[model samples]
Target: MTVVVGTVCVAVSCLIQSDPVAGLFGASTFGLVSAYTALFHTPRLLALCWTAAAATLTVLTVRWAGHDLAFVVSSALLVALVVVFVTFAGRMTIWLLDADIFHPNLDALTGLLNHDGFHEKAATLLTSSSRTDDRFFVVAVVNLDSYSLLRSLAGTIGVDRARIEVARRLRDTARSNAVLAHPSDSEFVIADLFTEPDTSPLIERVQGTINAASARLTASIGVVCTPLAPVAKLPAPDVIDELMAVASNAMYNARRAGGNRVTYVNDPALTVLDAPPTDEWPDDDTR
Candidate 1:
């Protein structure tokens, strides 16, 4: 709607100025073109089109009219338009892609790592951690308590608003080395980015942060030690499947135990506990 109104405003301004060329020079036109391309074109195609258009326009102006003030002005306008379009288009494209990747449904309250983003990033992290024997890493799965009640009482939209608030709090509380992603409506994954041997302190810090957020908003976290026993014979991606499964189980135990506690599978208490079973859940419901 903003794009449409801006476009109309640009058209009207051009008509008032009686300069058909002014339409081409207006920022609103650039904004409109950028919005249109973002809605329709893929990133690669958008880049190619903008590149070609810029080149063609510059070349045409240089050849058709000699290198004079008019030629310079046209060239400048063309360059500005291309830059504006590309800059805005690229930014919006990435924002939309990330939204699709991490916050698809936009209803993820307690904004933790969504499942897809967690697996993808956790795998990458595991691959890297495997190379350095000295480095220690951890994957923490966070499960929110009574999230269904929150949604039911506040409505889905209200739940979403709460999620945004919670997400911001999580970000504020996350360690410098943490990679946070939401994998479920109320679950988040935090990948510790520490290369040092001590990660327990960092994990504690994250847990404390979440615990401090709201008395009503409690989180049960499961930590899985990465590069699980029996070091891989093959160099693989930086994700440890065993560790992920273990952390997931710990999260399940946390949930089962009334939610709001940090549990680690490697902990003595969970040593004999069975791994959490998996439940089939919808991958995406983003409108």
Candidate 2:
């Protein structure tokens, strides 16, 4: 869209201006706008390609409008100036945006991706993967069942240490393809997708890891996976939410049943869709 609009503007300029330099002025303006837009939204190599294409078009328009060689060279120089200026401006703006927006994606406690970072990576993976390849997600909610009791008995420091240990166990258990995030103090949410591989072994491994962490702590696990049986496709955001809800429901069930178990539900509709199990967490822990 940016390229098309800029090309059209350059064409109009060629038609209205008799002088080569004047004809180039319009292309220069278009280049400046395009450079800014591309810098904000496009990769460096791609932006360079766009600038080169625009410069070529500017030269053509000047020649087509019957300008002298000196005038054409001068117009070409203008395009170069636009490229240099835009490149520097775009680089600076992108750096600022990255620093401000992306730096906070990691969790401070666990050194894992936080909620925003998890969402960002999940969206990217969901968009890139195709349903044709049996691509799907296994959204897992792993919570320390004994967190409240541990906090009561050992105080804040002990609970923090236990949380960090649990997070480390989970990260170790998850495969390289998985994305792990610490969304809450006691709960560590993990997303397994992209590879469309079996999650059973990994789930079992994670459960075992947490169970062996400490006798005082046990993890309640839940998962939601896709391409189960009937549903081959689902909207990205809807699927994410539904899976989270179902996994959450299973985790709640696990917590209700004494807390040291792994549970998963592929079909969310079969599960109770009422208000999330109120019995799941204490009031202070509401996200």
Candidate 3:
């Protein structure tokens, strides 16, 4: 929209001035404005098209204003240089902005989203998924059951190494598009585990990654799925907190039974506790 306005304004200025000097000045102004505007807001194709059109228009303006061949050549060269400047400056600005946004959300050690960042980014993803035919999403938290034991054996340095290794493995084991978060030392959460099938294999794969990290390391994951049962209809960001808690409870249940297992819980009411076992509760209706 701004591009359209800028382009139209430049053409009008060129037409009204009807002088060679005015034409050259207008071309320069247009080039700078378009470049900056495109950098901030316009699409790549739009920028490309605008650059071509502006160059052509500049030559035409010079010729229309009765300028000599030398002036026309100069105008074209100036316009091209302006375009190049815009491209370089715009790219640098974009890179800096992205770094600023990403640095805040990332966990320094694992380079995964911190708890707050995970919720923010994952919510955006879910909103996108909501627009599609997909009816369900999965949230799973992988907890290292042997974290304390690993620390006891490996010490702080060894523990950090193990965590880095585990974080990498977790990143690899999940689907390419999965949103992963590191909320605490021993906990890693995954969102957009979108497949609706039984989550057992998924859990097993996560556990396997941790076990592979070290002989002393094993993990239990708690997963809670939403809107799969007729009674469940979970909403965005708000529902995420509830689901995480329910999944955490299920994870604890797995911890209780012994570690290195997967537990799936569907808590429609998002209950902290008092969630019936999977076999006993068919739906999320909680009192």
- lDDT computed for candidate 1: 0.59
Q: Write model 3 residue lDDT over 1-287, tens digit each, in one string.
A: 56667766776676566565665555556556555665666576456546545655666655654547776676667766775677667777876777676588988788889998998877776666534444566789888887888789889988888778888998899888888999899898998644564666777888777787754587887888765332132345565777777888888988888978788875355542344444665566773
Best by lDDT: 3
- How should the candidates be ordered by lDDT, best one leading? 3, 2, 1
Candidate 1 weakest ten by summed lDDT: 268-277
TM-score quality measure for candidate 2: 0.54
The lowest-lDDT stretch of 10 consecutive residues in candidate 3 is: 227-236
TM-score of each: 0.53, 0.54, 0.55
Q: Which lDDT tens digits does candidate 2 get at residues 1-287?
A: 66556646655665467665555555556546555666655565446456555655555654655546676666676766785577577777877787667677987777788877887776565666654666556788988886778899989888888888888888788877678888888888888663454577878888888878863577898887765222323344555666778888889988898888878776456322333444664688565
The global Cα lDDT (0 to 1) of model 3 is 0.71
lDDT of 1 by residue, 98-202 (tens): 777756644344545566556665566555544436545577777777888988888988777656766777688776556677756777777765455345675
**For this target, which candidate reaches the highest TM-score against the unseen true structure?**
3
Worst 10 contiguous positions by lDDT, candidate 2: 228-237
RMSD of each: 13.6, 14.5, 11.7
In candidate 2, the residue pairs with backbone N, CA or C atoms under 3 Å apart (3 or more residues apart, or in different chains) clash, namely none
lDDT for 210 (candidate 3): 79
